[model samples]
Target: MRIKDAGDMTSKAQETTAAVSRQRHRGQPYVGQPMERLEDAAILTGRGRYGDDLGVKPGTLHAAIVRSPHAHAELGRIDATAALDAPGVHAVLTGADLVAWSRPFVVAVKAPMEQWALAMDRVRYVGEPVAVVVAESRALAEDALDLVRVTYRVLPPVVSIESALDEDAAILHPGVGANVVSDRRFRYGEPEAAFAAAPHRVTLTAHYPRNTCTPIECGVVIAEFLPGDEGYDVTSNFMGPFSLHAVMAMALKVPANRLRHKAPRDSGGSFGVKQAVFPYAVLMCLASRKAGAPVKWVEDRLEHLSAATSATARLSTLEAAVNAEGRILALSYDQIEDCGGYLRAPEPATFYRMHGCLTGAYDIPNLLVRNRVVMTNKTPTGLVRGFGGPQVYFALERLVQRIATQLGLDPLDVYRRNFVAADAFPYRAAAGALLDSGNYQLALTRALEDGGYDELKRRRDAARAEGRLYGIGFAAIVEPSVSNMGYITTAMPAEARKKAGPKNGAIASATVSVDLLGGVVVTIASTPAGQGHMTVCAQVVADVLGVNPADVVVNVEFDTHKDAWSVAAGNYSSRFAGAVAGTVHLAALRVRDKLARIAASQFGCTPAEVEFADGRIARHGAPEFALPFARVASNAPHWSPQQLPAGEEPGLRETVFWSPPNLEAPDENDRINTSAAYGFAFDMCGVEIDRATGRVRIDRYVT
Candidate 1:
């Protein structure tokens, strides 16, 4: 690996299966077709269910959050009597009201920052929810909220990244000095010497702006109360069952198992933005409790932009230590992240939980990473797609390319020298995470060919000579999915994590049912807003069971009952389809064993003698010995009583709550809590930078 940088991402570059391997389907047509989404038909026909689409209950109320207009301010009196009398006004609720009836909901995160579901006394940021109005309709909610008045005394605001980090910066929190929320520093090797001895080094300040996962169907949830009971049920377009359930349990002050979260189809798309949903969902649910009806909270475009979390806006100070060979000797970078209002949004874990992903795909020896989450008045930053990996990769790879150009080596050659070689399967990364397994060279080679990197370089040089400002950039990122949430617990203050809830039990679950009528249904607890869980699962199931993918059906709806899961890192890192496919295939294998036994009993042959042939069972040279599956299934119970395999049971079925041990950690197979397994990393984006304007445009991007 070139310059030893721990946890630094670099690019000069560029599913499923279970019981069935690729070697089994060389000549099959159904093996590789891109799957048509199961819900698209219903969605296109306007028949699919969404959170808001779930008909609101009678006397159901709608809400409009009256957000703080100032960034920081003194607590003041709120006048809502006028709002109470407004058209269709049902109720106007405040943070004080919540504090009086119910204590502030403070979900612990790894960060030291404190949070109340709503501001308890002072305002923190613009658009921070302070008071809420519940009314007859959404329009009425807005109208009634207008009549609610709050008087505040403004304080100096910390709004920029640099200002937030200053020693004398206004403390966002009274006791916590300055605006800094979290500060972490780590080192693996002697980076100073490496940088000094290196024949060449490159230092640059790079900035990655704020962007977020904007799912088409914005986040919307309608929480309904089962009449005459304190129990509440949630229906909406949400991300995963795990984290959402945990967050809700914390907010509602109920047992984790009591909150019933139901999702319908894909949630437009959440990426990392949906992690913020749970806190607010709890707020909406509590609002429903006051109104004595279901309450609907829908995020509009403006609301999403101003209120939803964004990626950590980072100003990275990057320095690379490189030999003439372009071998990385050490890498060190200091980064300042704009965490916005509170680090506790996702909590202490949100800022540094992705420390592993920030390291790209390279084998570096000594690495150093430093980051300080600075609290600003801007919207608090949370996870976005690629999470923090994209930011680190962009800075690292771009810097590496600059060093290669100075050393007169091909960027590709420089990149290859630092890559975790193909022979290095299950390589232990410099930053301490072990890669599951992958052929980096193969993927890079494929991407190079497919991307025309060689040809493009020549064209780029020519284009530059012709005064066309063309620049090509590449970043290879190594992202570990199923990031052990427990890591979040360990990194934070001991009490913070212990209070944050249980160590992540990263497990995912699926329920598969094959009725005698030839319908195959797979129920998954992880909801994929866009990633093709259905296609991937069908592909795996078809191969393992010798059935066409079209014959298999996947039911991905929003409900806590159909599928049970514990870890809720909502679908991002492109893990939804892959994780579900592997797990469901394992379940299918368990069911297939049951099928084989049923077949063995009916055909009067051992389970091993039966082989799946064209979706049916057949013995060598005995075509008449082949028994129809439905026929075999029908005779299993009846024949068992007559003669059969004596004690064997009939009707094939098996259910497994596969909670692999490494369920809370990286998908380290032997580890006790590993859940979703992701094994590869690749990212390339072409950028056009204007030095004069200090602006950059992504001309092309591939992930």
Candidate 2:
């Protein structure tokens, strides 16, 4: 489980590749080099600090939220008098109290539903928090919650996307008129003509089920209101898009400066699950303010499972317009995603994330996609790993297989015909994502060869001859990264987007500072969910600065107060490799440039003529003409200011931000890159379904 070096993993992968007759040559070290992770030992040895491990002040009260048992209900009355009299119970808070103390949570998407930390007026989901109990201990808080009775007039629930979309369905949010929250269509190229002129047309439909990552540690929050500064100091186990500072501040009716969020040094895991923890953060802050003391709440398994956000479930229909030879000319998609009870901040993000990859690995020149968001009586859905890609590819790839079946063509052959040419990149997808680089055909061919595709087919035919059932399925997907922050604004109308002003790009920030002793420290905005972020940071910085990976330190904890962050910051959206790594490299390069200049002065050479290698600066191709990197780094912080390079800053420090090139604002067409780089995964899964026991055994998966 401990990743020693970048090569450590490469060696194992090479062994596997060699077993499959795919051995390749090794390359340079550092960024692509192997190195052991520094964070693993502390984590594996039980020294990590997770959410529940942190506690508030001595007299801090504990809280337990009372959630709605009914999916749809009208609020009648809440009786908390008995709970206030319970043992050790300090106070019981209801929607009425929150109404006086706070505003509804902010919704980033242009949906009509108004959401609050605690449900008020009516409950739309089964686990909506209706009230809260605060006490000296968690046990007392639980007891107090039971004593506080809430009366509800239960109403019919809109439980499914189909039911919610019914013409006669009850509107989940009263003013929205229908369960539909947002609906729009986007088209690229001549889709109508392409479908009309095509000799072949294929369609596929499927429902991607809703799921959530059950992180080992559930949501926990501790908030202390500093009345002296009129600000709040909150510590929680949450991977934040520090931009939430403004969102939570707005909900609390305080200025953004009054709120600060910090994460523990270690988190169990968040593959997008922690995105939903913000609402609870504001709730705990309210509890603290109401009780006039710090407050803490640790969610139990039941609460976590029933209330936490999930990956949005989607129902999709995909169509392809193809030539007589099976080359796709156009693609179309009509999809309805269940947003659950509320369109929380960034709810509709799942729908638009794959806008650029709608055509998948194809070079379809014409495309159209119609997306609709629906609200149902379930937990709200937000970000998850592979958030939108899985659902989109499920439908798109299934269509690819169906096309092959109908046309009597090999699936791989059909895919090969449609793939974007290797040299065609940076090719623009029909939608608008300017794909940076890829060799789709090369990748697919290698995968087929390595997975023994031909051999598998032979085995399948032999099995069928013996009256055994076997099948293999193929799916091609484009995984997008470096989430464009401006893409979310597409949910708003053109006028609204314009009123919002010039759009910001998808950006990530990193700070690199060199110590007088020549050590490097990198602080990034991203928090790790055991993803070896520290290891990657070390590798990238060490490679850029000409130092050992072990010598470069990475600050893994994401504290909004300490990190150089942006609105696009967070661990979601598959952004690290494209955005974070690039930012870290840029920052490190700045530091390295300064070091080179200082070393050049000492070595009596021009900066451009000097090279940094083995932690020393020397004339290019001359190892003897060198200055130790440490001696040069010391000049910035320890040397007399007069001796510093002219026009150079005083410290060997740099902070840089990165945004993808060729990024454009969403036009009236609602088209955008959505992500900077597109990483493709071609998967072939072999499985056996045992009809007797109805069990599925996955025999092999090649990606």
Name the runs in model 1 displaced over 4 angstroms.
1-31, 100-112, 189-201, 226-230, 344-353, 357-359, 405-409, 439-457, 463-468, 493-505, 516-518, 613-621, 634-653, 659-703
Predicted candidate 2 versus true structure: per-residue lDDT over 1-703, tens digit per residue: 9646655654554344233221112224566544455676566545567777765578999999999999999988899999999999987777887877789877756656788889888998989999889999999999888888899998899988899989999888888888988888777889999999989999888899999889888888988777876778788777766667778888988787688888877788888888888998898888888888888999889998999889999999888887877888888899999989998877687887787678878898999888898999899898877788888888888888888888999888998998899999888888778788889999998989999888888877877787767788888888887777777777777778888875647778999998777778999888778888887888787667666566678886676666778787878777888788889999989888887786677677888887766666678867788777777777665565567778877777799988877667777777787787788878887777776787887778899
The RMSD of every model to the true structure, in order and in angstroms, is 9.0, 5.2
Best by lDDT: 2
User: Which residue pairs in model 2 clash with each other?
Assistant: 4-35, 4-36, 5-34, 5-35, 5-36, 6-34, 6-35, 7-34
Whole-model Cα lDDT per candidate? 0.67, 0.81
Candidate 2, after superposition: displacement of residue 420 in Å? 1.7
Candidate 1 Cα deviation (angstroms), residue 187: 2.9
* Top-TM-score candidate index: 2
lDDT tens readout by residue for model 1, 398-498? 88788788788887777788888888866665544556677777777887778777666786688788776777766666655665555554345444444
TM-scores of the candidates in the order shown: 0.85, 0.92
